[model samples]
Target: MNESTELGEDFKCKLPNVSMSTQSKTMPMIDLKVYIRVVAAVFSISSATALVMALLRLLTPNLFYVEPLDGSNIVLHYFITGLMVVTSAIGLLNSCVVMNRSAAKNTGRNITTWLLLDSLFETTRVVYVFICEVVIKGRGSLQTYEMLISIAQYLLDSFLYCQMILRH
Candidate 1:
């Protein structure tokens, strides 16, 4: 019995020391700055694409046109397209600021504030478009694709902004 006890003690002594603190903890896969920069780049590309689509719809209606509900009133269609262009420009500008800050090594509350404002504006713009085209005018089918894309963008931007704020 003593020999067995001695053998058990020797076995215990040979084992590596491990504790709760020593164990690897789950950590973020990427650095916060890198994440911000990547997300900002994505936002920039999306904004640029939206801008191009809006411009195309505006300038070359024959090639890329999502016809408005009131076909007779071209003015409203132009106005909505103009709004999209302006909103996309704002989004692009905000993203550029975020991306530039990563290079400058400047992470400030002001940038996060700008991000919040941009997200709010983007959500508002999407909501307005939904109300105007789908609800009021009853023209949802014509621009379903654009509307869905815009809604998805809004959700993604909101989620990314929240994550950025939390990380910051």
Candidate 2:
């Protein structure tokens, strides 16, 4: 009877170990690099969209006229879109630097600095667009859609900027 009891205790210990191993195997995994890549993809897409807008405005001005800058000429729109493309490209490059596992500490600091500048510029642009297009001129302009999209992009960039700073 004592030998049977000892056998049962050994079986119980083996069962728990098997269960623990299975639990660990079944656990969900999270990869931070994937998120960083996702942000980079978003930046790329934003840059592409801005580039397309710039091209459409340049090639076919009648089809893509901005209401706010209606009297000012399409040059302003082109300039704004160009700025977006440049900043988004910078953001993508910064994200790549961040994803490098062997990147030096100074490289990380540089990435953070670039992200900070991008975030600040985006924030200012959003506020300026909101105030100029929505507040002073009213929301009747067709550029409101563009303004909202830019605002969303700004928010996403700001989130990524915060993440980069926190991680580094």
Candidate 3:
């Protein structure tokens, strides 16, 4: 019996990092949930800020465009900015869902879905802004700074989501 006790101790000690036995008593369930929440929170806040910027551009049309060159651009801007507002609001709600510890277990799928949707929005918005920056404003428009920021944010978020997806 003494030898058996020693063997059991050795087994526990040799267990891998994710051993439920090891982490269960220590942290319970804060590990994955907290990290996921943090990521989602960042995504939410950034999306909100994007929403604001889009709204401002929509409100001040001439401020974004030097001249009223075409009707198609005005419509496209209106449509894309509206999408940004809706998607960002959903993204913010998703963050709140992940932040609540008692909400649900096995939320990996749901969170992944949200992240995928956010990724799509982020990528598409950056592309749309870039095309407008180059074609409409010669790449040095008033929205240039916002466009650059969006590009950087999208790249970072894409990398993080990719890593998280791979882990799960």
- In terms of TM-score, how similar is model 2 to the real structure? 0.49
> Model 1 off-target regions past 4 Å?
1-27, 60-73, 102-105, 135-142
Query: What TM-score does candidate 1 reach?
Result: 0.64
Among all candidates shown, the one with the greatest TM-score: 3
Candidate 2: Cα lDDT at 150: 64
Q: How far does residue 124 in candidate 1 sit from its true spot (Å)?
A: 4.1
Which has the better TM-score: candidate 1, or candidate 2? 1
TM-score of each: 0.64, 0.49, 0.69
CA lDDT of each prediction against the hidden true structure = 0.68, 0.54, 0.69
Instruction: Tell me the tens digit of each residue's lDDT in model 3 across 64-157.
Output: 6767747776677777767776776676666666666453652767766777777776766776576567656623365767777777777777
Of 1 and 3, the candidate ranking higher by lDDT: 3
Off by over 4 Å in 2: 1-32, 64-75, 92-107, 120-142
Clashing pairs in 2: none
With a 3 Å backbone cut-off (N, CA, C), the pairs that clash in candidate 1 are none
Give the top-scoring candidate (lDDT): 3
Q: What ranges in model 3 sit over 4 Å off?
A: 1-30, 101-103, 138-141
* Model 2 whole-model lDDT (C-alpha atoms): 0.54
Question: How would you encode candidate 1's per-residue C-alpha lDDT over 1-168 as one tens digit per residue?
Answer: 999999898888565766665423555467767887888887887688677767766776544334533555466657777888888888888888878874455467666666775775576467546644554453434355656776777778778777777777
